[model samples]
Target: MEIIVVIGGPLEEGAIRRWLHQKLQQKDNQKFQFIGVDGGCLKLMSEELPIDLAIGDFDSISSGDKEILKNYAAKMIEFPSEKDFTDFEEALMWVAKSYPQQKIHVLGAFGGRVDHAISCLWTMFRPELQALIPYLSLEDEWNHISFLTPGEYVIHKLEHTKYLSFISTGSVKQLTLKQVKYPLNHQDYDFPIALISNEFIDEQMEISFESGGIIVGQTRDSWR
Candidate 1:
């Protein structure tokens, strides 16, 4: 099963359809568990998308909207508005605990406030979410994000993505980039750095690192 988590970020009906279509193409005959976070449930309903589970504090939306969610959502989990973790983090924790074997694809998490975006990115590094690193991804029309541990990986370029970047959240050692426009040779970085704007020379590219976590992003300049 694939869990689709939608949050409160900029989203378009056409873009959401296009993205979901791509996901269907990749995995044929798979079931989807739609999760709506707070105000994001409003967008999902407006788009006529399914909401298997609704999660959040319900503080961002009006009572009418919450009533709509209560009627349509198969299940709902509510949290306190004054909490330590963000709604996104709470949703992730719930998903990780409940559906550990399922792949999680998050939407509407990009193009928001800089701090919110960063918080969502770092959620993967949480100790409880460590096991989900390989299975979790954040994507939108313009960008696709994934996490990588210490291992060699051959990742293919996503459709409409022109640039590939690898960013380190902590110490990254012996990192190498292969079959890319600007290749790296086992370079080491003690601090976080972004190897940005690198293009793919072919359909796929190779990357490997010995230590630390790397956030891989494939992005385009705009929605074409």
Candidate 2:
């Protein structure tokens, strides 16, 4: 089963209804089990969508929202607000353990708080959930980011997105890029701005790295 988790963050306020409509239009919504975290419960309920499970401390959600979610969701999983893991992390851990093969698409995982955004990115490195890397992605309004293990990979450029960035998680031995505007031979990238903001001129691009993991980010400007 594929899982879609909506976290507690600022969603394009008035766009939830239209966004949910568009999302369900292109994909088989029946195949997905919707899960809401904290304030995300409100957003999901506001769209009149069914939430299969709701997980979070509910600190960010109002009492009224909690009542609404409890009424609509099939199951409600609550944790103490002082728990060790962030709500998102806890939700992901549950997913990883219960539905290892499920693809996870996280929305509202970015924006609002900068530290929260950074923490969400760093959560990809947690030892327990590292094995779920391939199945996980964090998406916001303009960007999609995910971690990749050392291997040969192809990235098909999505329409209207002009830029791609790859940052190494550790010391990369031999990294190569093909069919890109600026191709790279076996080169080293130290997890920073050196290889950021490269344009993709082709329909599809290929990348390979001999050692170390990498985070790939595809972004487009709103004007595009």
Candidate 3:
């Protein structure tokens, strides 16, 4: 299944507009199922997009908007404002159980409180979610974040994603980056490093790891 999870966490001071623009980028899009958490429901609605499922405490939405969502959403999963897991986590867990092989595109998850963004980043590290990494991509206006298991992978150039970063979640052995600005030849990383930024020199990039795994962040050239 191709799924898109929209989380309504707080965004950074200047990011909300760009984030909204990113959502607007998808017009007449009919390829994926949308899952809105909290205020995210309104986001999808504003875009004139159909919502497949809406899940959240929904304290952020007005009663009238909630009624519209209930009528428009194909399925509703409501929970109390006070819960053990975050609304996004709850939605993710449900997705994991219902569609284990899903390729998830997450938006409206970053540009928030630092900790909140970290929580979204760590979702890929979860035991239940790790297996879904290769199929998962956390996206925003400036980044395409993904987690990958040990294997050879080829990544193609995407319009907005130019800079690349590979971080070791655990201990990655013999990790290699091919045909990039800074190519790595069988490098080993026991502890995680910033690996902050690199660029693509060609249309395609080749990444591989002999053991362990990596969390890859493909970002835009926002500095330009």
Give the TM-scores of the predictions, in the order they appear. Answer: 0.94, 0.89, 0.83
**Clash pairs (backbone) in predicted model 2:** none
Regions more than 4 Å wrong, model 1: none
Tens-place lDDT per residue, model 3, 45-123, is: 8776778999989999999999999998999999999888888888888888887887788888776688878888876
lDDT of 2 by residue, 1-224 (tens): 67888888778865555544545665674477889988888888877777898999999877887887788999999999998999988999999888887888788877679988878777888887887898898776567788888889998875535689887766886799998888999987655434788988878999998888788888888566
The global C-alpha lDDT for each of the candidates, from Candidate 1 onward, is 0.90, 0.81, 0.80
Q: What is the lDDT of residue 203 in candidate 1?
A: 98
lDDT of 1 by residue, 1-224 (tens): 88999999888766677888877887799898899999889888987889998999999899988987899999999999999888988898899888997888899988778888898899889887888898899998788999999999999988768999999999999999999999999999999999899999999999999999999999988746
Clashing residue pairs, backbone N/CA/C < 3 A, model 3: 12-111
Would you list the clashing residue pairs of candidate 1? none
TM-score of 1: 0.94
Ranking by TM-score: 1, 2, 3
lDDT of 1 at 3: 91
Better of 1 and 3 by TM-score: 1
